[model samples]
Target: MEVDYSDIRVIGFDADDTLWVNETYFREAEEKFAELLEGYETKNKIDQELFKMEIKNLALYGYGIKGFMLSMIESALELSNNEVSQATLSEILNLGKEMISHPVELLDGVEVVLKQLKGKYRLIVLTKGDLLDQERKLERSGLSAYFHHVEVLSDKKEKNYQDLLSHLNIDVKEFLMIGNSLRSDVLPLVNIGARAVHVPFHTTWQHEEIEEPKQKTGYITTNSLANILEYL
Candidate 1:
Protein backbone atom coordinates (compact mmCIF):
# COMPACT_ATOMS: atom_id res chain seq x y z
CA MET A 1 0.00 0.00 0.00
CA GLU A 2 1.22 3.49 -0.80
CA VAL A 3 1.17 5.63 2.32
CA ASP A 4 1.05 9.39 2.08
CA TYR A 5 3.44 11.77 3.83
CA SER A 6 2.08 14.95 2.25
CA ASP A 7 0.24 15.74 5.47
CA ILE A 8 3.21 15.07 7.76
CA ARG A 9 4.11 18.36 9.41
CA VAL A 10 6.07 17.03 12.34
CA ILE A 11 8.71 14.35 11.98
CA GLY A 12 9.97 12.51 15.07
CA PHE A 13 13.26 10.69 14.87
CA ASP A 14 14.50 7.89 17.10
CA ALA A 15 17.97 8.84 18.23
CA ASP A 16 19.94 5.82 19.23
CA ASP A 17 20.22 3.37 16.37
CA THR A 18 18.44 5.57 13.87
CA LEU A 19 20.88 8.45 13.87
CA TRP A 20 24.00 6.94 15.41
CA VAL A 21 25.54 3.65 16.49
CA ASN A 22 24.02 2.36 19.74
CA GLU A 23 22.96 -1.29 19.83
CA THR A 24 26.40 -2.34 18.63
CA TYR A 25 27.93 -1.12 21.88
CA PHE A 26 25.31 -2.95 23.88
CA ARG A 27 26.03 -6.15 21.99
CA GLU A 28 29.71 -5.81 22.72
CA ALA A 29 29.04 -5.14 26.39
CA GLU A 30 26.80 -8.18 26.63
CA GLU A 31 29.49 -10.38 25.18
CA LYS A 32 31.97 -9.16 27.77
CA PHE A 33 29.36 -9.62 30.51
CA ALA A 34 28.74 -13.18 29.41
CA GLU A 35 32.46 -13.86 29.42
CA LEU A 36 32.78 -12.49 32.93
CA LEU A 37 30.11 -14.85 34.20
CA GLU A 38 31.20 -17.87 32.22
CA GLY A 39 32.55 -19.61 35.31
CA TYR A 40 29.10 -19.60 36.93
CA GLU A 41 27.13 -20.77 33.88
CA THR A 42 27.42 -21.46 30.23
CA LYS A 43 27.54 -18.36 28.00
CA ASN A 44 24.12 -19.25 26.62
CA LYS A 45 22.59 -19.57 30.06
CA ILE A 46 24.26 -16.39 31.20
CA ASP A 47 22.90 -14.50 28.22
CA GLN A 48 19.38 -15.80 28.86
CA GLU A 49 19.53 -14.99 32.58
CA LEU A 50 20.87 -11.50 31.88
CA PHE A 51 17.99 -10.81 29.54
CA LYS A 52 15.53 -12.02 32.15
CA MET A 53 17.15 -9.83 34.76
CA GLU A 54 16.91 -6.79 32.49
CA ILE A 55 13.20 -7.36 31.78
CA LYS A 56 12.50 -8.00 35.45
CA ASN A 57 14.18 -4.79 36.46
CA LEU A 58 12.75 -2.61 33.69
CA ALA A 59 10.21 -1.00 35.98
CA LEU A 60 12.75 -0.26 38.67
CA TYR A 61 15.68 0.84 36.51
CA GLY A 62 13.96 1.77 33.24
CA TYR A 63 16.18 1.64 30.11
CA GLY A 64 19.86 2.58 29.71
CA ILE A 65 23.38 1.39 30.24
CA LYS A 66 23.07 1.96 34.02
CA GLY A 67 20.08 -0.34 34.21
CA PHE A 68 21.85 -2.83 32.02
CA MET A 69 24.85 -2.71 34.33
CA LEU A 70 22.63 -3.31 37.34
CA SER A 71 21.02 -6.24 35.59
CA MET A 72 24.44 -7.66 34.77
CA ILE A 73 25.48 -7.41 38.39
CA GLU A 74 22.25 -8.99 39.59
CA SER A 75 22.52 -11.77 37.05
CA ALA A 76 26.07 -12.46 38.09
CA LEU A 77 25.09 -12.67 41.72
CA GLU A 78 22.13 -14.93 41.03
CA LEU A 79 24.07 -17.23 38.76
CA SER A 80 27.05 -17.40 41.08
CA ASN A 81 24.88 -17.70 44.19
CA ASN A 82 26.47 -14.49 45.49
CA GLU A 83 29.93 -15.91 45.06
CA VAL A 84 30.90 -13.82 42.10
CA SER A 85 34.13 -11.98 42.88
CA GLN A 86 34.20 -8.26 43.64
CA ALA A 87 36.85 -7.91 40.92
CA THR A 88 34.43 -9.28 38.32
CA LEU A 89 31.74 -6.85 39.52
CA SER A 90 34.18 -3.99 39.09
CA GLU A 91 34.90 -5.14 35.58
CA ILE A 92 31.20 -5.15 34.79
CA LEU A 93 30.92 -1.60 36.03
CA ASN A 94 33.84 -0.66 33.85
CA LEU A 95 32.05 -2.17 30.88
CA GLY A 96 29.05 0.03 31.52
CA LYS A 97 31.25 3.08 31.88
CA GLU A 98 32.95 2.28 28.62
CA MET A 99 29.60 2.24 26.88
CA ILE A 100 28.48 5.47 28.51
CA SER A 101 31.67 7.24 27.48
CA HIS A 102 31.88 5.83 23.99
CA PRO A 103 31.80 8.47 21.26
CA VAL A 104 28.68 8.71 19.15
CA GLU A 105 29.12 7.61 15.56
CA LEU A 106 26.45 8.92 13.24
CA LEU A 107 25.08 6.63 10.57
CA ASP A 108 25.57 7.44 6.91
CA GLY A 109 23.35 10.23 5.53
CA VAL A 110 22.02 11.14 8.97
CA GLU A 111 23.18 14.75 8.65
CA VAL A 112 22.06 15.08 5.04
CA VAL A 113 18.61 13.76 5.83
CA LEU A 114 18.26 15.96 8.91
CA LYS A 115 19.49 18.95 6.95
CA GLN A 116 17.03 18.25 4.17
CA LEU A 117 14.06 17.92 6.53
CA LYS A 118 14.98 20.38 9.29
CA GLY A 119 13.39 23.51 7.79
CA LYS A 120 10.69 21.60 5.91
CA TYR A 121 8.98 20.29 9.05
CA ARG A 122 9.22 20.27 12.82
CA LEU A 123 11.99 17.81 13.67
CA ILE A 124 12.12 16.30 17.12
CA VAL A 125 13.81 13.39 18.84
CA LEU A 126 11.55 10.73 20.33
CA THR A 127 13.53 8.02 22.01
CA LYS A 128 13.80 5.97 25.18
CA GLY A 129 16.79 5.46 27.50
CA ASP A 130 18.78 7.17 30.28
CA LEU A 131 18.10 10.85 29.88
CA LEU A 132 21.61 11.93 30.76
CA ASP A 133 23.13 9.30 28.53
CA GLN A 134 20.90 10.25 25.63
CA GLU A 135 21.68 13.92 26.14
CA ARG A 136 25.38 13.20 26.22
CA LYS A 137 25.10 11.29 22.98
CA LEU A 138 23.16 14.10 21.37
CA GLU A 139 25.80 16.56 22.42
CA ARG A 140 28.50 14.36 20.97
CA SER A 141 26.53 13.63 17.82
CA GLY A 142 26.46 17.31 16.83
CA LEU A 143 22.90 16.78 15.62
CA SER A 144 21.21 18.56 18.51
CA ALA A 145 20.85 21.78 16.52
CA TYR A 146 18.65 20.02 14.02
CA PHE A 147 15.94 19.07 16.48
CA HIS A 148 13.24 21.33 17.85
CA HIS A 149 12.56 19.07 20.82
CA VAL A 150 14.08 16.04 22.52
CA GLU A 151 12.02 13.53 24.47
CA VAL A 152 13.46 10.63 26.41
CA LEU A 153 10.52 8.39 27.04
CA SER A 154 10.52 5.72 29.74
CA ASP A 155 8.78 3.42 27.32
CA LYS A 156 7.39 3.53 23.81
CA LYS A 157 3.87 2.20 24.11
CA GLU A 158 1.00 3.53 22.02
CA LYS A 159 -0.18 5.69 24.89
CA ASN A 160 3.28 7.19 25.26
CA TYR A 161 3.23 8.28 21.64
CA GLN A 162 -0.30 9.61 22.05
CA ASP A 163 0.79 11.67 25.02
CA LEU A 164 3.85 12.90 23.12
CA LEU A 165 1.74 14.01 20.18
CA SER A 166 -0.66 15.73 22.56
CA HIS A 167 2.17 17.49 24.38
CA LEU A 168 3.70 18.62 21.11
CA ASN A 169 0.31 19.96 19.94
CA ILE A 170 0.52 17.84 16.83
CA ASP A 171 -2.39 16.13 15.18
CA VAL A 172 -2.10 12.40 14.83
CA LYS A 173 -2.17 12.41 11.05
CA GLU A 174 0.50 15.10 10.89
CA PHE A 175 3.09 13.14 12.88
CA LEU A 176 5.69 10.85 11.35
CA MET A 177 8.15 8.72 13.35
CA ILE A 178 11.35 7.30 11.87
CA GLY A 179 13.43 4.72 13.65
CA ASN A 180 15.02 1.27 13.67
CA SER A 181 12.74 -0.82 15.83
CA LEU A 182 9.37 -1.78 14.41
CA ARG A 183 8.10 -2.75 17.84
CA SER A 184 9.03 0.50 19.53
CA ASP A 185 9.26 3.14 16.83
CA VAL A 186 6.92 1.99 14.06
CA LEU A 187 4.01 -0.09 15.35
CA PRO A 188 3.10 2.16 18.25
CA LEU A 189 2.90 5.26 16.03
CA VAL A 190 0.89 3.42 13.36
CA ASN A 191 -1.46 2.08 16.01
CA ILE A 192 -1.97 5.62 17.26
CA GLY A 193 -2.93 6.82 13.74
CA ALA A 194 0.43 8.43 12.98
CA ARG A 195 2.78 7.61 10.11
CA ALA A 196 6.07 5.76 10.66
CA VAL A 197 9.13 4.64 8.70
CA HIS A 198 11.39 1.80 9.73
CA VAL A 199 15.13 2.08 9.01
CA PRO A 200 16.58 -1.20 10.18
CA PHE A 201 19.86 -1.10 12.08
CA HIS A 202 22.47 -3.75 11.42
CA THR A 203 22.04 -5.07 14.97
CA THR A 204 18.91 -4.78 17.09
CA TRP A 205 18.17 -5.80 20.62
CA GLN A 206 16.20 -9.03 20.97
CA HIS A 207 13.51 -7.20 22.96
CA GLU A 208 12.78 -4.98 19.96
CA GLU A 209 12.33 -7.80 17.45
CA ILE A 210 8.91 -8.38 15.86
CA GLU A 211 7.65 -10.75 13.21
CA GLU A 212 6.51 -8.83 10.15
CA PRO A 213 3.14 -9.84 8.85
CA LYS A 214 1.86 -9.04 5.40
CA GLN A 215 -0.84 -6.44 4.84
CA LYS A 216 0.16 -3.90 7.46
CA THR A 217 -0.21 -0.61 5.62
CA GLY A 218 0.23 2.33 7.96
CA TYR A 219 4.04 2.65 7.62
CA ILE A 220 6.94 2.48 5.24
CA THR A 221 10.22 0.59 5.63
CA THR A 222 13.39 2.11 4.24
CA ASN A 223 16.77 0.43 4.05
CA SER A 224 18.65 3.55 5.10
CA LEU A 225 18.06 6.92 6.74
CA ALA A 226 18.63 8.63 3.41
CA ASN A 227 15.66 6.81 1.90
CA ILE A 228 13.34 8.67 4.28
CA LEU A 229 14.10 11.85 2.32
CA GLU A 230 12.08 10.55 -0.60
CA TYR A 231 8.87 10.56 1.45
CA LEU A 232 9.40 13.67 3.52
Candidate 2:
Protein backbone atom coordinates (compact mmCIF):
# COMPACT_ATOMS: atom_id res chain seq x y z
CA MET A 1 0.00 0.00 0.00
CA GLU A 2 1.23 3.49 -0.80
CA VAL A 3 1.38 5.94 2.10
CA ASP A 4 0.97 9.65 1.53
CA TYR A 5 3.10 12.36 3.12
CA SER A 6 1.63 15.27 1.18
CA ASP A 7 -0.78 15.80 4.03
CA ILE A 8 2.00 15.84 6.61
CA ARG A 9 2.89 19.28 7.91
CA VAL A 10 4.64 18.48 11.19
CA ILE A 11 7.24 15.72 11.30
CA GLY A 12 8.29 14.26 14.64
CA PHE A 13 11.53 12.36 14.93
CA ASP A 14 12.65 9.92 17.63
CA ALA A 15 15.98 10.96 19.07
CA ASP A 16 17.91 8.02 20.46
CA ASP A 17 18.83 5.32 17.96
CA THR A 18 17.03 7.05 15.14
CA LEU A 19 19.22 10.13 15.19
CA TRP A 20 22.27 8.95 17.15
CA VAL A 21 23.84 6.07 19.05
CA ASN A 22 21.82 4.93 22.07
CA GLU A 23 20.78 1.27 22.39
CA THR A 24 24.34 0.14 21.57
CA TYR A 25 25.53 1.77 24.76
CA PHE A 26 22.86 0.01 26.76
CA ARG A 27 23.84 -3.34 25.26
CA GLU A 28 27.48 -2.65 26.11
CA ALA A 29 26.51 -1.69 29.66
CA GLU A 30 24.58 -4.96 30.00
CA GLU A 31 27.64 -6.94 28.88
CA LYS A 32 29.82 -5.25 31.46
CA PHE A 33 27.07 -5.64 34.04
CA ALA A 34 26.96 -9.36 33.36
CA GLU A 35 30.70 -9.58 33.84
CA LEU A 36 30.45 -7.73 37.15
CA LEU A 37 27.96 -10.29 38.42
CA GLU A 38 29.54 -13.31 36.77
CA GLY A 39 30.66 -14.74 40.09
CA TYR A 40 27.04 -14.93 41.25
CA GLU A 41 25.36 -16.30 38.12
CA THR A 42 25.73 -17.10 34.46
CA LYS A 43 25.75 -14.23 31.94
CA ASN A 44 22.35 -15.21 30.62
CA LYS A 45 20.85 -15.28 34.09
CA ILE A 46 22.39 -11.93 34.97
CA ASP A 47 20.98 -10.44 31.78
CA GLN A 48 17.51 -11.83 32.52
CA GLU A 49 17.51 -10.61 36.13
CA LEU A 50 18.62 -7.11 35.17
CA PHE A 51 15.95 -6.84 32.52
CA LYS A 52 13.37 -7.92 35.03
CA MET A 53 14.64 -5.41 37.56
CA GLU A 54 14.40 -2.64 34.98
CA ILE A 55 10.81 -3.46 34.10
CA LYS A 56 9.83 -3.89 37.73
CA ASN A 57 11.20 -0.47 38.54
CA LEU A 58 9.99 1.31 35.42
CA ALA A 59 7.11 3.04 37.16
CA LEU A 60 9.30 4.19 40.04
CA TYR A 61 12.23 5.49 38.05
CA GLY A 62 10.73 6.12 34.59
CA TYR A 63 13.51 5.98 31.95
CA GLY A 64 17.12 7.06 31.47
CA ILE A 65 20.62 6.38 32.79
CA LYS A 66 19.80 7.10 36.44
CA GLY A 67 16.95 4.60 36.44
CA PHE A 68 19.14 2.06 34.69
CA MET A 69 21.91 2.63 37.24
CA LEU A 70 19.57 2.00 40.12
CA SER A 71 18.23 -1.15 38.49
CA MET A 72 21.77 -2.48 38.04
CA ILE A 73 22.51 -1.84 41.69
CA GLU A 74 19.36 -3.68 42.74
CA SER A 75 20.04 -6.55 40.35
CA ALA A 76 23.59 -6.83 41.65
CA LEU A 77 22.38 -7.08 45.24
CA GLU A 78 19.88 -9.79 44.34
CA LEU A 79 22.22 -11.74 42.09
CA SER A 80 24.91 -11.76 44.73
CA ASN A 81 22.62 -12.23 47.73
CA ASN A 82 23.80 -8.86 49.06
CA GLU A 83 27.40 -10.12 49.06
CA VAL A 84 28.32 -8.04 46.03
CA SER A 85 31.17 -5.75 47.12
CA GLN A 86 30.64 -2.01 47.53
CA ALA A 87 33.37 -1.50 44.94
CA THR A 88 31.34 -3.57 42.46
CA LEU A 89 28.29 -1.35 43.03
CA SER A 90 30.40 1.73 42.45
CA GLU A 91 31.70 0.20 39.22
CA ILE A 92 28.15 -0.37 38.04
CA LEU A 93 27.41 3.28 38.69
CA ASN A 94 30.48 4.17 36.66
CA LEU A 95 29.12 2.17 33.75
CA GLY A 96 26.05 4.41 33.71
CA LYS A 97 28.12 7.57 34.13
CA GLU A 98 30.20 6.54 31.17
CA MET A 99 27.03 6.12 29.16
CA ILE A 100 25.73 9.50 30.30
CA SER A 101 28.96 11.14 29.27
CA HIS A 102 29.32 9.21 26.06
CA PRO A 103 29.56 11.48 23.01
CA VAL A 104 26.66 11.69 20.59
CA GLU A 105 27.17 9.93 17.28
CA LEU A 106 24.71 10.91 14.56
CA LEU A 107 23.56 8.15 12.31
CA ASP A 108 24.45 8.40 8.65
CA GLY A 109 22.27 10.74 6.57
CA VAL A 110 20.63 12.22 9.67
CA GLU A 111 21.89 15.67 8.80
CA VAL A 112 20.93 15.46 5.16
CA VAL A 113 17.42 14.36 5.99
CA LEU A 114 16.87 16.98 8.70
CA LYS A 115 18.39 19.78 6.66
CA GLN A 116 16.26 19.07 3.65
CA LEU A 117 13.08 18.91 5.65
CA LYS A 118 13.77 21.64 8.21
CA GLY A 119 12.28 24.63 6.47
CA LYS A 120 9.80 22.79 4.30
CA TYR A 121 8.16 21.03 7.22
CA ARG A 122 7.63 21.76 10.89
CA LEU A 123 10.21 19.49 12.52
CA ILE A 124 10.04 18.47 16.15
CA VAL A 125 11.54 15.80 18.38
CA LEU A 126 9.09 13.59 20.26
CA THR A 127 11.26 11.13 22.13
CA LYS A 128 10.75 9.51 25.52
CA GLY A 129 13.55 9.56 28.10
CA ASP A 130 15.06 11.53 30.97
CA LEU A 131 14.69 15.20 30.06
CA LEU A 132 18.15 16.30 31.12
CA ASP A 133 19.87 13.41 29.37
CA GLN A 134 17.89 13.88 26.17
CA GLU A 135 18.61 17.60 26.21
CA ARG A 136 22.33 16.96 26.74
CA LYS A 137 22.37 14.59 23.76
CA LEU A 138 20.44 17.03 21.58
CA GLU A 139 22.85 19.81 22.46
CA ARG A 140 25.71 17.52 21.55
CA SER A 141 24.07 16.33 18.35
CA GLY A 142 24.18 19.83 16.76
CA LEU A 143 20.81 19.15 15.16
CA SER A 144 18.71 21.30 17.47
CA ALA A 145 18.41 24.07 14.92
CA TYR A 146 16.26 21.84 12.81
CA PHE A 147 13.54 21.06 15.33
CA HIS A 148 11.01 23.72 16.33
CA HIS A 149 10.33 21.91 19.60
CA VAL A 150 11.63 18.96 21.63
CA GLU A 151 9.57 16.88 24.02
CA VAL A 152 10.92 14.33 26.47
CA LEU A 153 7.97 12.09 27.13
CA SER A 154 7.77 9.60 29.98
CA ASP A 155 6.23 7.02 27.67
CA LYS A 156 5.11 6.69 24.06
CA LYS A 157 1.71 5.10 24.42
CA GLU A 158 -1.26 6.15 22.26
CA LYS A 159 -2.63 8.56 24.84
CA ASN A 160 0.72 10.21 25.20
CA TYR A 161 0.87 10.89 21.48
CA GLN A 162 -2.71 12.15 21.41
CA ASP A 163 -2.13 14.56 24.29
CA LEU A 164 1.09 15.89 22.84
CA LEU A 165 -0.37 16.49 19.41
CA SER A 166 -3.38 18.20 20.96
CA HIS A 167 -1.17 20.36 23.16
CA LEU A 168 0.98 21.33 20.24
CA ASN A 169 -2.12 22.28 18.22
CA ILE A 170 -1.12 19.76 15.58
CA ASP A 171 -3.90 17.91 13.85
CA VAL A 172 -3.51 14.14 13.57
CA LYS A 173 -4.08 14.33 9.84
CA GLU A 174 -1.11 16.67 9.40
CA PHE A 175 1.25 14.81 11.72
CA LEU A 176 3.89 12.24 10.77
CA MET A 177 6.49 10.49 12.93
CA ILE A 178 9.69 8.67 12.04
CA GLY A 179 11.83 6.54 14.27
CA ASN A 180 13.77 3.33 14.88
CA SER A 181 11.40 1.59 17.30
CA LEU A 182 8.14 0.33 15.87
CA ARG A 183 6.64 -0.12 19.33
CA SER A 184 7.33 3.33 20.73
CA ASP A 185 7.72 5.61 17.75
CA VAL A 186 5.58 4.09 15.05
CA LEU A 187 2.66 2.05 16.37
CA PRO A 188 1.34 4.58 18.84
CA LEU A 189 1.15 7.27 16.19
CA VAL A 190 -0.61 4.90 13.83
CA ASN A 191 -3.05 3.87 16.57
CA ILE A 192 -3.83 7.53 17.16
CA GLY A 193 -4.70 8.15 13.50
CA ALA A 194 -1.37 9.71 12.54
CA ARG A 195 1.20 8.45 10.01
CA ALA A 196 4.57 6.91 10.94
CA VAL A 197 7.67 5.64 9.18
CA HIS A 198 9.81 2.91 10.75
CA VAL A 199 13.57 2.85 10.25
CA PRO A 200 15.04 -0.04 12.20
CA PHE A 201 18.20 0.50 14.17
CA HIS A 202 20.99 -2.07 14.03
CA THR A 203 20.33 -2.87 17.70
CA THR A 204 17.12 -2.28 19.63
CA TRP A 205 16.60 -2.60 23.36
CA GLN A 206 14.75 -5.81 24.13
CA HIS A 207 12.06 -3.80 25.94
CA GLU A 208 11.33 -1.88 22.74
CA GLU A 209 11.08 -4.97 20.54
CA ILE A 210 7.64 -6.07 19.33
CA GLU A 211 6.30 -8.61 16.86
CA GLU A 212 4.49 -7.27 13.80
CA PRO A 213 0.72 -7.69 13.85
CA LYS A 214 -0.86 -10.09 11.35
CA GLN A 215 -3.31 -7.38 10.32
CA LYS A 216 -2.10 -4.56 8.14
CA THR A 217 -1.09 -1.32 9.85
CA GLY A 218 -1.01 1.85 7.78
CA TYR A 219 2.51 2.73 9.03
CA ILE A 220 5.32 2.56 6.46
CA THR A 221 8.71 0.92 6.96
CA THR A 222 11.89 2.23 5.43
CA ASN A 223 15.33 0.64 5.53
CA SER A 224 17.20 3.75 6.65
CA LEU A 225 16.61 7.27 7.93
CA ALA A 226 17.54 8.54 4.48
CA ASN A 227 15.20 6.10 2.79
CA ILE A 228 12.18 7.90 4.23
CA LEU A 229 12.99 10.90 2.07
CA GLU A 230 11.60 8.97 -0.86
CA TYR A 231 8.26 8.89 0.95
CA LEU A 232 8.36 12.47 2.15
lDDT of 1 by residue, 159-181 (tens): 99999789889999999999999
Point out where model 1 deviates above 4 Å.
Answer: none
For each candidate, how many residue pairs have backbone atoms clashing (under 3 Å)? 0, 0
Worst 10 residues of 1 by lDDT: 212-221
lDDT by candidate, in order shown? 0.93, 0.93
Model 2, 124: alpha-carbon shift in Å? 0.3
Off by over 4 Å in 2: none
Residue pairs in candidate 2 whose N, alpha carbon or C atoms collide under 3 angstroms: none
What's the distance in Å from true for residue 46, model 1? 0.5
Q: TM-score for all predictions? A: 0.98, 0.98
**Shift of residue 73 alpha carbon in model 1, Å:** 0.3
